[model samples]
Target: MSTHPTTARPMDGTARAAELTARTAAGAAELTRRTGTAPCLATVLVGEDPASVTYVRMKVRRCELNGIRSRQVVLPAGTTTDRLVEVVSGLSADPEVHGILLQHPVGAHIDERAAFEAIAPGKDVDGVTMHSFAAMGFGLPGFVSCTPGGIMRLLDAYGVDPAGRHAVVVGRSAILGRPAGMLLLARDATVTYCHSRTVDLPARVAEADIVVAAVGRPELIRGEWIKPGAVVVDAGYNPGNVGDVDFAGAAARASLITPVPGGVGPMTVAVLLEQTVRAAAVQLGEDPAALGL
Candidate 1:
């Protein structure tokens, strides 16, 4: 007999993503009507990591769906950190580029944080920089890391109030994991941070009213560790389209759980587009609705 992971409800990210995409498409259409040029997102990818390539492509495809044009820059494996920084700085200075998404984990030798900092905060639509992180933590006016932002939106849409809830976030990556915990904490969720060195990871997870599995390791979170009636948000995008949690098992016990491919993935691009239009409007010091106004 096969044992299944326990979960209460399966979170349907694909359906929710579709709704957001439809809304973004309409927003893009309006932006195009007002501004001569369609909202454009500049994407830069370094090296030849298959996952990064695929992710960039996915983001670009979603941009098209939302009527946003994308400008792609594919760099070679031997590209130096200074060269990468120069490229990003140029994008930050570009007037027509409203948003920028730097495909991360360039390489062990590449200075990713330096590259992220090169992007102007206003144009950092992907929210991968320390500036963006602090802004989101302070609840200030800045773009959020798309996947984390999407998860927060999902919670709101499902009416899963985070106030006073025990939220245990696993992982500490700057982009997804760290921001996810910060976002939850900001919502008054009483969050706990867990990483590779975290002791009794299972116990911590079992105590969670809300679980955010963002560690890149596939199936790192076991289903039996989840507390009953808890909501599970998986922000992982591991290779082979696997999530950090065991969805099959977790869904058996979770009140809601996001699927691997369709769950947090599509929402990332949606939030990116949402912020891209805002960035474009801000650059011109004009109201976003003024386009529609």
Candidate 2:
């Protein structure tokens, strides 16, 4: 029903992410120059899921490139929830650590929420805490869950206005889908959340002006279900690097669509690093505004 062009434009997330990362690096360098303290991100990973390990490695590498320091904490798969919480709490208490990121899907037996709460709100750069979720919902200035924050950034970069738009977020995971909808709602978009239990999922998705495919199932959101000219933000990174949306089919119908590897993934890291620099500035008593926060 939309009048926008059917010839879709690929949103160049890689380029935008690079631009933001460069800016963050510059800001980090300046902050370090002023305070003699580089921004530090402490990453905690429980049970080495290969994907999680690779993600953490990528984050650490980006930190190095951006002049931020990374401290790695690796726990065995059998570690208890309490031990994990203690480790995160220890990092939170360390004044030298400016930010904390506990990688997702920390072993099946561990209480993820309890472990996440161990991170101090100020240092939760990954934005997994209840406090961060509240702040995001209220449109307050606080750290956001990285992927959702990155999606917002992508929307802005592409000149997509979210106000009054009907946005369908197709997942409800604590970190990805839920927060993404909240962020969209904060920007004045009308948001509907859909999951496995939702009735007639395709019908619901077709009604959206903006579609965010965050469900882990690859190609779950078929291209035919995309409203013509709608903006599609694919946040899923399934095995084989496929996104939740059928990229080929959706790209034909969407006015703007993100490609799998080059889209949301890069931006996630960029936002994380950017927030780490900001956290450092705040913790060091340096004015974040002065660093172009």
Best by TM-score: 2
lDDT of candidate 1 over 1-293, digit per residue (tens) = 01333435556677777887777677677777766668889999998898789888888988887788999999999899999999999999999898999888897888889999999998999998889999989988788899899999889878899999999999888888889988988899899999999999999999999999888899999988988778989887776888899877788888888888878776777788888877877775657665432
Going through the candidates in the order shown, the clash numbers are 10, 0
In angstroms, give how far residue 293 of model 1 lies from its true place. Answer: 13
Model 1 spans > 4 angstroms off:
1-7, 289-293
Q: Each prediction's Cα RMSD?
A: 3.3, 1.0
lDDT of 1 at 181: 87
lDDT scores in order: 0.85, 0.94
Q: How accurate is candidate 2 locally (lDDT)?
A: 0.94
lDDT of 1: 0.85
Off by over 4 Å in 2: none
Question: What lDDT score is found at residue 231 in candidate 2?
Answer: 96
Instruction: List, residue by residue over 1-293, the lDDT tens digit for candidate 2.
Output: 36654967999889999999999999999999999999999999988899899989999999999999999999999999999999999999999999999998988899999999999999989999999999998989899999999999999999999999999999999999999999999999999999999999999999999999999999999989999999999999888989999999898889999999899989999999999999999999898879876
| Candidate 1 residue 105 C-alpha distance from true site, Å | 1.4
